[model samples]
Each structure stands twice: as C-alpha cells, then as structure tokens.
Target: MAEALQPGDPAAIGPFRLTARLGAGGMGQVFLGESASGRRVAVKQVRPEIARDPGFRKRFRREVDLAMKAGGFWTAPVVAADPDAESPWVASQYVPGPALDEHIAAQGPMDEAAVRRLGAGLAEALDSFHRIGLVHRDLKPSNILLLDDGPRVIDFGISKAMEDGGGSALTSTGMVVGTPGFMSPEQALGAAVGPASDIFSLASVLVFAATGEPPFGHGASHALLFRVVHAPPRLDGVPPGLVTTLDKCLSKASEGRPSAHEVGAMLTETAAPAAGRPAAEVDAGGIPFDVRAPSPAPESAPTAPNPRAAGAPAQGTYIAPARRVPPPPPAVAPRIPVTPSAVHEFAVQDGGPAVFRRRIRKSALWTALITAVLCTSTALIGQLLAGVFLSVIAILVGFLPRLVGALPLLVRSSLRIDARVLQMRLGGTAFTVTWQDVALVSVSRTGNTLRLVVVLHSDAKRPVPAPLRRPGADDDREAEFLLISWNDQAVTSRAARLHATLAAAAGPAYRPPVRG
Candidate 1:
C-alpha cells in the first residue's frame, strides 16, 4: 500500500497530481499520482541535487527513453517524462501490486510453483530488455512487482543502454551502480556489463524468491560485493530441480550463463511434471513447455496397479511398465548468421551540430561562472594573491581541459556502410570493421540524441571513444564498440529509417531497439 503524501511532496508534477508516496531512494522519490483523465501513474521525481548535475540529467533522460522503449506487458510502462523540469521526473503506469520483497516479507518464501512462475515472468521481462539494447542494471527482488497476471519489473533508474552513451555518472572507478547482494561478478568488479549480467542478477533474485535469502547472504555492502565477486552463491534451501539452472546463471563468466529465452524454457521444462510424478513420464509427452498449466494425461493411459489387492501369493512382485525419456531439447545456438545476404550500403553523419554547440557553450559558461564565484569569494576574504593563484589554477586544472574537450564536438563525424564493411570517422580517429567481425548492432534515442552501438566479435580490440564504446567496456569480453552517436532534433524524424537500413545491412546480427 502507498503511504499518504508527505508535507513537502509536490501536489502535482507535470499533468499528474501526486497523492501518495510509493517509495524513496537516494536519487529520487516515487509517488502515486493520477492524471486529469483518471489514469494512475507512478511518478519518480529526482532529488534536487541529482537533477542539478548535467551528467545525471543526461543519463536520466537516456534511461527514461530506454524504459519507454521496453515492452509494456512485463514492465511498468513509461507513460510520461519531464526530464527538463525543475526536479526532473518520469511517470510510469501504476502497478497495483506489492513489490516481490514486500510480498516475501509479509507472506514468506514462494513455493516451487510460484517461484517457477516468477522465474518465467522475470526471464521474459529480461528477454524483452535484451531484445532491445537495454540491461536492467538493478534487478533485485524489490524491483519486481508481483501481480495477478505475472511479475512486472520496475525501477529502470539504473538501467544502461547496452549500446553507446549508457553509462551513469554515479558509477566511477571503484564505484558500482547495483545492489551488492544482487550484483553480477563483473558488476561487482566495476567491469563492463551486458545482457548476461542481468541473467546473473536474475539467478540471485530467483534464489532469494525460493529461499527468502539472497544467495550471497547478509552482510555489509563491501563484504557482500566481495562475496559476489569471489564466493559461490549459497543455495541452502533452493529447490533441487532449480539448483542446476540457478547455478549456471550465477556462473562467474558472463558467457557461461544462459540467455533469458533459454532460461524461460529451462524453467518451463523443469516445472512441467506435477509433484511426485516421475521425470521420465513427463518427458515422454513431447509437449511444448508451458509453466501455467500441466499437460493432461492421455485418455488411454493405464493406471498404476495396486500392490495391496487380494492375490493368491501375498508377496508376489509385479513389474511396472518402463517409461521412455524424451531427448533433451535442442541447444539454443548463439545468434550467428546462417548465410550471408547481399551487401547493402548506407551512411549517416552528425546532424545536430547546432544543438551540440549550444550545449557546449552552456556547459562552458556554467563552468566559468562556478570558477569565478569560487575565486571571487576567496578574494573577498582578504586573500587577493591566493584568489588570483587559485583562479589561474582552477582555469588551468578545470576550465581549459573542459574547453579543449568540447572542441571535438565541432568535428563532423560520419558512419559509412558498405556491403561487408562498417567504417566511421570521429574527429581525428577512424574505426573500421568487417561484417563478419560485427556481433550486434543496436540503436537508442534519448530526446534529440541518437546512439548506434556496434558490438565486435572479440574483446581483444583497443577501447574506442565513449560515443563508440559499449556500456561497461571494462568487462566487455565481446568487444562491443559504439558505432555512431549524434544529438539533433531534426534527425529524430529519420531515426526509424536509419535503424531499418542498418538492420537490413547487418541482417540477423542487428538487435534493434524495442519500439512499443
């Protein structure tokens, strides 16, 4: 249940009228709100401090776009957003269910069937994110809502685009973006993350759902982070049938974990047989896996013979009919092209130069103002020489570097597409790739900025620029690179065409952004 709105909470945000407080976090407060049309929404208002940071605003807007792009069936659909507001905010459809954490706390651990359902639902949700280019960096129990239909994954606050420019400013060297107990090994190590990272976290969430205890157990954040990186998960009370699949999800290597689609199938298969039924009998049906209902027994199936029936010999042994075990399901092959298609060609260039220049100017102006204020304040305290020295130092240490860095924004970068090769020139650097060397191509749009991500086939390649680097590049074993990024409102109209063109060129390798 939501708590009544507090004294200081805003009565309204954008078009939504705030009525109650759903939750609060370090970055923001979530409120239960209602629109004039009677539609309910969960409005998240970022704290003033976080909203003030330009970098955080950029990340927040990017994440909001990703959240909006995510499929609505398994997630709290993003209904509206005002990232440019005084206190940046986003509103998603109001999910009328308790969080998984609250449900577990109030009702105790979930039973095997319930856990299976939860696993399937959450896996499907993650699959939706993976299909696009997003990863729910935080996938803890609290982030999941248990509804009558199924679980709904919420709180995409920390989600990063697997594509380019998805990293959050909150995470830096030695800092991480996820909860300790739920973090994957790579995440704990502050390494680059991918879809597999969410898979690892999903396994941890399943363990918690089954046993009511996080797989890593309880401790200080540092200790839990350490254990997540080095120790095997504790599955003391997890159901036997789920242990193998969960263990695979918790694998130290990201590639070792199963895909979300595969995990859904595994959970479905594992949950097929009714309680106490022989595994062999269940496998013999060759029925498509469905977690919601068990396959019905055939009409001609024979009942088990009763051993206690009257007979001439009291202790006579009777042999039961043998049951044939079905063959294991076919392995899910990695997304590789079965055959090459005809070479296609397309190209794109930075179309937002005017916007980029305006942004750079604003940033430079803010930096200069802040620097001047600091120096002037020092001088007002009767320290003229010190103020002058500090001002010069500040300009050299901060202003000059930022000004120099912004110079690249003026350079015209373009992506050239050929039948079998992808090439890009950003400022003074040039990156080239063969079609065979490309693993995945994904696109994401945040307001006016459009980002295209190109994942390489190997991790041995040198790191590329931030606009061209994959999210979590530090732990990027797949060597994913950013292909192109630009911030232009005019190009937004052509985004779909560009994305479709690229997808056609990349064929099966492209992972297009989710549209609805």
Candidate 2:
C-alpha cells in the first residue's frame, strides 16, 4: 500500500484529490479519494510497469468499459473512468463494508438465512452481467463486500464481453484466470465458458458463506483445480435445501448446471418452505421430490415384452400372504465348496413395472448350502463320542440357511436411497411391501456402537412383517443411521435408476432428496 496521507497531501489527480491509501493488489493500488462534488470513491490506477505496455492498456480499457456498464443493485455504482490519461484509472462508489472473506474470518460463518440472502443477492448480480452477454471472470469471496442490505460483488477488471472474444494476454497459456478455489471446471481448464461458469463460481461463493470456506478450500492452485474438475463439493454443514442446488451448479460438466436465473428462482422458491410450520412438509411447487419406484407384483410380468416399450402402468394390487419367512440365521461355521449349477434358479426380480424377476446363475446358493452341510455333519458325528460336540454341530447347522440369505441383504441395505418397497428373499419365500405398509427404519446408539431397526408397518388384517435386525444393532432403533452402512454409492445409484423407472410410469418428474 502507498504511504497513508492526510488532508491536502497534494496527490490530487484531475477533480478528485487522493485522501488515503485503502489497499493494493497485484495490478494496482486503491486509494480513498473524494470527488469535487463531495462524493467518496475508491480509485484504482494501473501499475507504472504495466502502464507502458500497449496490450495491457487495451485490456485495462476493456475493464473500464465493463465497470461503466455493469450496473446493478448488488454492485457498487461506477463513478468515473479515464482510459486515455497518463495512467488509466477507474473509480467506483466507496462501500463501507468488510470483504466477505474478512467477515467470515472475523465472525465465523453466517447462519442459513444470511447465506440464503447472500446467494439470492449474488444471483441477481450475476444475472445482470449474464443478461448483457458478459462474464465476470473473477468472483472470489475477497471481491465481494458484505453490506448491511446484502452482498455487493466488485472488481470486474477481468470481465470479458462475448463480443471481445476471450480472456486477456495475462491468461495466454490457457491458464486459469479466476481464483483457484472458486473457478469452475471449464474455467480451470481454460475452455470457453457461458453463463453456467459464473453459476458454478457463485455456488462456490455460497459454500464459503455457509461454511466459512470454499468447496475446494485452501490449497495450492493446481490441487484446487483438480478438486474443481473431479471432486464433490465439501459441504459438511450446509443446509440441505441449498446443497442440491449448489451441487447442480458445481457439476463437473457445464451443461449439467442450471443458469443464474434458475438459481435465483430456487432461492426464491425455497423461502416459501419457511412460511409453513411443519419441518418436513412436502413442498407443493418446489423441486420434484421422487425417490424410488414402486416394486412390480409377480403376476404383472409382461408377455412378449417390447425391449423399447414405454413404461406400463404399474399394477399395484396387493398380494395375499402365505407364511412369512424369517431372516436367514447368522453364519456359524465354514463348509465344503459345492460344484456350480447345483441349486435351482428362482425368478425374484423386484421394483420393475412389467418384468419382476429374471433367471440368474444359481451357483452361489448351492455353494453355500453344500458348505453348511459338510460343517454340520462333521461336528454331529464327533458328538456321539462327546456330548459337548453335539452343542457345536447344532449351533452350526441351525443358522446356515439364514447366514446364506443375509450376505446379499447386508449388501442391498447399504444403498443410500429411499425405496418404495424393500424386498428380501429367504429360503423358499420372499418378503415384499407396499410403502404405506412399511414403518420407519430405525438407527440407535448403544454405548459406543450404532444399530439399525427395520420397523414394519403393523396392519390390522395381515401377519406382522418380520423385524430385520442390523448385525450390530441388537434390535435397537435409535442409533445414527449411516446412509453408507447399508446402501453405498453404487446402491444409491441403483435406487435412483429404479425411481426414474417408476416415475416414468407415473407420469411425473422425480428429484431425490439431498444426500447427507
């Protein structure tokens, strides 16, 4: 920064007299200046070294033009610009507020409402630039002022007009132009960007306001670029409503994101949820909230099904209950390997409209059963010599079938998706459900461990649904539900696919809940 000066310091330029040095950046110094009309302004002058370069002056001229025209409620109004002078300068109305980065460092992160206000205001500001075919290539938290009314985005020195073609010579190597933590994937790659690129940056800014850090956060520029290109945004404590919208904006592919206008509408519509008292009330006109598709019944299997047929209306008729099978018992002992193709195949497909089950290789069940029998018989024969051996064999054989069935069940539960009907196949029987007939899935904490409970929807006319116990839960239902414990990323993706299938048949768009 230049030396702080007092009144009448004789650093006057044109009608404005420089009062004090406010701050300095790589390109220029910002001075506190007062115009002849008694208006305060922050004047920035091009560095002397860069001033001699003709190319730099042209770029500086473009920045001046962008600042002059880019007027909005969420931006400090431009006061004056002189590109033809000895040292080019631009002055904007002096705003008395801390930079967003400084505000967060001084007083933690703003709460949800403040973050929302910041997002909406910034969205409106970006919309103004986007509407006129301009891109503010730099939009880091430091460039935003946290005012009492809302945020005001400043520093359009790198803003590029579509008519001006692309970035200036400063980014000649296809190098990124914006701050690393806030740059979109396209911007990081030095690719031509449209309005979505700014939307991505805007999302990064919101993340910073909500969490006191950008999604990519503090790191070397190259590392940050890698995260921007391939990693998910790290939003550990952000509100759920904003998370999905932020995720959309920070998509790796530019086309996957919504425009600035869509972001503004989302912020506006999200406010309506607060008007209602219920916490988890279904939003009537908000974004779609479909989860998983309803499972198809066995009798509805299509005959001569068309491979490319449109989804058929899901026949939702409930099936009459026979005997409900218990979950397979826990694994007790290891057994002999069985030959392939030893067990009969059963059609048990689920969650489809027409085709419910399909024939799959039956080798796995055979292998499990054969191993169980061998382990059981070995201990049983030895028990004749010693009665104590009998206890061991009984324990081993009793739980064999249950163990065989449970391995697949555990795999399916780890999927992080809400299913309409959860299905589990035990030996000789299958358990299917209509969503309304299902109760809550419980997560409980006991000591240092966590447990899960699948509480069935108790019905008046039907047999009680089996209580599926989590392995470590011991039938408790209060443990923290780890979304990844049962259904991992792969299973969640599968659930999404199922939901899409059912939604197609139902004639409504579907959007899943925000993943925790």
Evaluate all candidate structures by whole-model CA lDDT and list the values in order. Answer: 0.70, 0.58
Clashes of each: 3, 16
- The total number of steric clashes, by the backbone 3 Å criterion, in model 2 comes to 16
lDDT of 1 at 394: 68
| Candidate 2 C-alpha error for residue 374, in Å | 88
> What is the total number of backbone clashes in candidate 1?
3
lDDT of 1 by residue, 222-270 (tens): 5466557655677877878899999999998998999999999998876
Model 1 stretches astray by more than 4 angstroms: 165-167, 276-516
Off by over 4 Å in 2: 1-10, 49-53, 173-175, 272-516
Error of 1 at 190 (Å): 1.6
Model 2: per-residue Cα lDDT over 1-516, one tens digit each: 235875644397556889888776435777888988888888877667557766767767776676677787779877887777787777888888779887666545554545665687788888888887778877888889865455788776566676666455656534467788888888876788778888899999888877766786454455456557655677866777788888888888889989887898887676632332223222232322112122222464322322213554233211111111222434742111121321212212222222211111243355456556655676687633344454445446654454553344333332222224334344333444433454454333333223323444445123333333334543332122222212244343333333332222111112223436
